[model samples]
Target chain A: MTETLTAPAPETHPRYAIEIDGVGKTYGSGDGAVTALDLVNLDVRKGEFISLLGPSGCGKTTLLRMIAGLEDPTQGSIWLPGRGLDGLGFVFQRDALVNWRTIIENVLLPLEFKGRRTKAAYQRARDLLATFGLAEFEDRNPWELSGGMRQRAAICRAMIDDPQLLLMDEPFGALDALTRDDLNFELQALWPDPEKTAVFVTHSINEAVYLSDRVVVISDKPGRIVDITEIPFERPRPLEIREEPEFGRIARHLRGVLDGHSARRA
Target chain B: MKKNPLAYIPMQVWTIVGIFAVWQACVMVLDIKPIILPPVPKVLGELFGNFGLYLRHGGHTLGNTLIAFAISVVAGVGMAIGIVYSKFLEKTLYTLLVTVNNVPKVALAPLFVIWLGTGNASKIAMGVLISIFAIVIDTVLGLRSLHPDLIDLGRAMRGSEFKVLMKLRLPNAMPSILAGMKVAISLALVGAIVGEFVAAQNGLGFVILSSQGAFRTDRVYASIIVLAAIGTALYYMMEYAEAKLIPWHESRRSHARPTAPSKPAKGPVAQPVASDAKA
Candidate 1:
């Protein structure tokens, strides 16, 4: 972590919220080293929604973790502007809700940690849970809620403090298809707020195409970005759009590039 | 299926009733001498008749057990936390504890008596010596058992290590800590009894030992019954504390069933929230 110095994108105004410059990651050294990521570069504009889509072991998660500041790139650097990396909300594949806390308390946890919890903060947490259809379950423990509800609670927690950036790692990957569909809609509903940027990592091509403004395909083993396909579709896209021929074509195109990099993936 | 917990009362009562029946049956059928095996009525009479005497010694035993157990709880959990947060302590203190625990703790009773003298200090020290291991070992395991995702989440939130330890780690370790306490409390009681056996002049253990020496077999039986009651009480007290403290834990949840029903299912069942399978 101490070895690399991140230089900001050469832009003066900082149009990009995140600038990932030729980042690479290698674990260990000498005899038994493993390169998890190759020299990968990406720039996500402010308010952009991007998905790093690839099969497992493609180091997509590793890349996402680097962006979240949980890991450091072995080379190059990631420069996060605006709120920077510290002021961000993160959702894990598992709900990762603190089971002992009531849903509201879990949501307020980050704020509490920040020493910023106030009466208004509590209200904000309540409103966020209510928006996620979890108002009634606010006082209930995480284990008492269904999987989808628990994840919604987790999302509420992530959003409670109005973080400028959101990082989600396969947030809906564990749920049933119907529940996943529900959450996807819920997420899309809130995505238009306040130029907040999000970097999502997922293995599902459909999820990438459906939710992201652009899909970045990554190759397996020493993951490198193979393609970045921008969606031409309009905002607040209805679920019916996925039925369109163009949507299928775009999804298939991303999948084809992903498949080209490694083996075929569902 | 578990509508009324009261339904299990008869089951519990009958099991105890059945054990007493077996005891009485053995006494009658074996034709044991009255001095050797007091009849149920005689023993019960001795218990009620000498309730004051039992109460006095019982109080002494209970007091020593609780004081020693409290000290062990504080020291044991403290040591566990220390071991978890410091590799130095983990390497030295924890390793030493593991080695020390393998020795029979009762064998150390005379040592405590010699070192701390034949008073509450030695008795309490013995109780702590016998019981502290479970707390340290279990609490350490529980503290280290946090899901890695939780650690990452803590980091993602920029939570300080101390904040994470206090708010997340400690609460998560509570169930394990309480479990250790349950075992420790019983062991503490046993330690106090061993201390009393080695040198003490009072308490239930001394009562039992002295009564046996005088061939007052009924008093010995009475003191034992009281001791059993105390051990059972301590265990259940710990269980009650565990249930109250961490009812959300899966192990404690069956006892805390959601009897209030769902919160009237708000929001439409068909949430328009699902974005049309978007592109």
Candidate 2:
């Protein structure tokens, strides 16, 4: 594990932790080319929870994948100061747990890959599982767990390494409404640790408003960022917050943005 | 109600017994010539009477089959790995393999005998040639058919290329490789038999050939029985290995039989957690 490097100038307090400048991704070439993301630029501050809220085929996932270093932008650049691949974690839309391994083994997989499977790492895995209500099911296969439990376990797997930045691509999209709500709250409770930052991608307007500090909404068809809304709700938000006037207002605004995009495209 | 364990025998077992009884009754009622269609009793008698001779020849056949199967597994898996790791090998070697596999293996039996001599070497060679392609194709398919999400997870975890292959890809491919092994084992037996048919002094194939020449239909039937038993045993052995190795696999899980029925008197069983019916 790498230590967090102190910011060079404390007075300035680096406004952006990550800088994505004019990044564009085009797939293939020569008449067969398709642009996934076009001139998308966004900056994320340290320890902020940002959601890339968009409709399908909006390049949100493609953008997330690029941030995770799984893919590279064909144009422009993305810069994360004093961060390496080891400091990043990803939670996919599907549980993505290795079917053959136990929950604890899956959680400890990143450590295993780094050849750093110490006793402390095992303890950390157990602790994370316990936190996620998966302690008793550590030895069970992924198939044996419910969808919610599996996704929770996946979250544990991602966070076990104590990544500074967590990239989640619709991590709760496959779950039922009730399970998705519970997990959204769980995620909210988990994201407050000041050292951790998160970039969440989702199609749910309510989810973006409920959990994100800011929602970056993108439009489809050579996807580009249309708006970045700053959410004013405080940390550790309660479920009742959803029923509040401000929450409804934010959700409605995001829904309008999405509906307007679709209407115009049609 | 307590049921008799004997009554729990599979339907296939009962069907086989019925077929044998019908065969015996046909020979008796029709008064068929012993030379034409020998009675089941006579075949059983020959099998039991020449038990030692049968055992020696069966051992030779089994040895040839096993040695050939082992070689095919190693070479096939090796080739699969090579093909999977290299696009050039997949394009060139895979086509050649498929073409060679399509050729009639029995036609090549005499060629193997000529090259490796009329001994265990020839039999093993025939087995390798006959069985290797299925193993290669099945294993290659398994290795390549990994779930994309799993690959992405591995990459996100920073697994090296070697680590991905060893931990993620190989284990994911095990069930397919085992399926291929089961198919290859049966083909291996056929190859050994074909080689023995071309030229051999020992083995069940040799016994059957010599008995047919001497007009001993019962011995021929006995030799065939031994061959069937060997094939069935090898197949089940492969199945048992597959069950043990990949119990997590859907095929193995679906095949698992409940040890005992739940007691209806106890009412509905309470699950510890809400089972994800949709999952």
Candidate 3:
């Protein structure tokens, strides 16, 4: 608990980007307390794409948020080396782009807040929109765009500041299946960058297996890690890789691990 | 690509014309006494013939209404912000505003006249009293309705509280505030007239009051017509301003009227579809 909110000194673990040592979160104390996460420990390597895959109310989002310092852990300590809240980027399940702002302006919002809304930053936003194929839609309002485009804009907003650690909480969960698949491919195309480490939360096993360097299966209630599977898929894994037998094997195994935990609880 | 304004008027215009035609038809068909409801032509004749008198008093009313509305918008929005940010004010000021607003404003207008005198001061005071609550209540709703993530994103970026308020919170709240303004503007006219009803030298309210004693039905009808025009004008003015200021809002997403420009009219919104699935 003392660890989640504090600005700890830079860590000596150069190989690890984030260190969670017995981190737990509980909403209240004593009789009314609802434990969201049990004491959980995990180490995230530098430049890794890790997914916390679990069912709803499994505290996957809570865990991701604790790392982002949106929620304080009530027990143990999670260390972020030196990339505190300011050095992290967070994307929610909803796009939540300010409807009044144009797409480019929405992306530039973080910079404006940080007093970094310079000419170069504006250009950087344009470039990011271009990367997402939203270049022509820079000045259009969020409502004018499709659901998928709005989500893309939200992603751009997170990345505009070039945050070292990006945390996303089921970012594509609200979209239609087809749109979600399209965004998943688009996201994986740009992500797993060596410069950035991403912590993603999702219940979709296929998505977790497709994009993650490692998929961590979390148990249902008072969430704790049940199993961690290293995805051995090679670099620049194309969208077609999801069709491969090996990809299904990895996905099915993760699903089995999740079902085993749920059945045991049942 | 300039289109003819006369070619296609909105249904509202035709509806208004139809109402006038129906009024004239009813009067002609029934042979109703002018005292009960004056003939449409007679009212229109009086309206056009003595337009200067009506204009003079109408100008007075319009000026006071605008002044009160401007003051209410500034002060009410400020009060809303204060209530939102301060727990103390949310409890004290917001509750007090709702309580005062619930009191019968017509009864309160005479009280304003007693306090501020029979001049425009009392009228303006009444207008502010009646109109300000909507501005405050709606603005508060708007400010609070902002997605929690927007605030969280601000905190994550270490953004100044002031910047988040000005850019994120206020802009997001604009349409709601403007909606309140629209309701307030019409209510403002009602307040001003109420004040004039109790005691005022000149206004549309005064015209209606004085003409009633003389049984000058034409003059009364003319004054009512003038008030209707003014009220309609004020409403549309607010609507047009809402369309202009927050064209990105959903309220403006309906078919492009002369007042509201649609999305395509905005420059260069061609979404690139070829790269929808890829970078």
Candidate 4:
């Protein structure tokens, strides 16, 4: 496991999009305080797809929230060197679409918030919806759609702003296996463009392997990075890639690392 | 697609008609005294005989209710916004509002009449006092009930606090605020009647009391009927407004029946003949 795991290269003039430096987060105060993340350092290069894979109690979500600037780290800072905070997009486990807004309006929320509702923006929103197969349901209320459809609309919304960084916290965790597989493919097609970066958090090792270029495994209860392994799969991976021998090897390797951490904690 | 118009009548209307018929029959069969319980026809006659008097008093009561209801809505929504936006107001003003709401406005009616005089002002004050609490509580709940993830999305987009409040919080709170308005409107009517009972020159409440003093039970029954009609009218008016404003809401959608299935349409098609020519 140690041989396969490699530290991120320290570039001299790094064009990193997001750099987390020794970040730590603690909730509450006095004796009741709980540490969520500690000494977490990672560099997400421009256009890279990374996954934070950990158990439920691990601070994977907290880390993602910190990067998105929704939560503050108690000890360290997340630096997006050149990009503004506005260049961040987030997709939560829940679709979180406003019930009152129609599907098209929900997708256009960020643009509306910025007062950028030009004709071009509208066309772009419609095009994104069409790509995600939600164009027919544009006028319908968010509650009228099925769960998978709502999640797809939510992803469309996050991408509408063309953010430099996309932080997704188990976006398909609530979905069934078939729908999850479908969305995983859609997400793979949507991300890793030369202009955008994505950091995904998931508990499923297969999901992390299938969607990510690099998988950062974290330990439970006060999360800290345990191993960072680069997947050697080529681009445009099919569903059949999960059946390949190398896919099984990497998944078993991740499971072994997770089991070792659990044993030590016990 | 067309259907009978009678199907549009709600079950509630049938129940009301049945109640009136039973009351009329019981009065004729049992030989009950008119003073104790007037027959439905006598009450109807009273209502028609002095229609001008009932209309005048009914108008006064309706005016007072509408004015007070308007005032309570503005003040209640304003206070709710204040509480939602500021933690200080949530802690202090919200608790103060709940404490004040617990004191019966009926008990305070005489004080209002004494201070503001027995004109429309006192009655309107009483209405505002009685109805404002529910509006405030419900609107505050609605504004604060936004999903945290939605707010996070807004923040990630670098939306200003005012933008979030106007675009996200207020629109999301509309259904709940409308629900509160329904409760408040009814309470406002009660408050106005209570105020008229304490001291008033004219109103359905004053008519009922004056008729009771003169032992004109039929007129009392007539006035009671007018008050019930006013309450029902106001409630339905609010319902109409809610339906118009939030057609997407579940409450409005529940009123619609599923549409009929459509027949499949025929289209031109190209058929490939069975061929066995492989080159």
- Candidate 3 chain A: worst-modelled 10 consecutive residues by lDDT: A1-10
Per-candidate interface C-alpha RMSD?
Answer: 7.0, 8.9, 8.5, 13.0
Candidate 3 segments whose C-alpha is farther than 4 A from its true place? A1-11, A176-178, A243-246, A263-265, B1-32, B256-279
lDDT, candidate 1, A1-266, per-residue tens:
23223455466346787888899999999989999899999989888888999889889999989888889888888888766766689998887787678989999999888888999999989888889888788898766666778788889988887877899999888777777877888887776655788889999988888888889999987789999999877778787888999999998898779777884542
TM-score of each: 0.92, 0.90, 0.88, 0.89
For model 4, residues A88-134, the per-residue Cα lDDT tens digits are 78887888787678899989999988888889988999999999888
lDDT of the candidates, in the order given: 0.83, 0.84, 0.83, 0.84
On residues A1-266, what C-alpha lDDT tens digit does candidate 2 reach at each position? 11112213333335566677788999999999999999998889888999999989889999998887788888877766645566889998887787678889989988888788999999999999999777788988766667788788889989988888899999988777877888899999976667888999999999998999999999988799988899998888998899999898888888888888773658
lDDT of 2 by residue, B11-120 (tens): 98998789889999999999999998899988999999999999999999999999999999999999999999999998999989988978887898888888999889
Candidate 4 global TM-score: 0.89
Off by over 4 Å in 1: A1-13, A264-266, B1-9, B255-279
TM-score of decoy 3: 0.88
* Listed models, DockQ each: 0.39, 0.32, 0.28, 0.23
Alpha-carbon deviation at B158 in model 2, angstroms = 1.8
Per-model TM-score (chain A alone): 0.95, 0.93, 0.95, 0.93
In model 4, the clashing pairs are: none
| DockQ for candidate 2, C-alpha atoms | 0.32
Question: Over the full model, what C-alpha lDDT does candidate 2 score relative to the true structure?
Answer: 0.84
**Arranged by DockQ, best first:** 1, 2, 3, 4
In candidate 3, the residue pairs with backbone N, CA or C atoms under 3 Å apart (3 or more residues apart, or in different chains) clash, namely none
TM-score of 2: 0.90
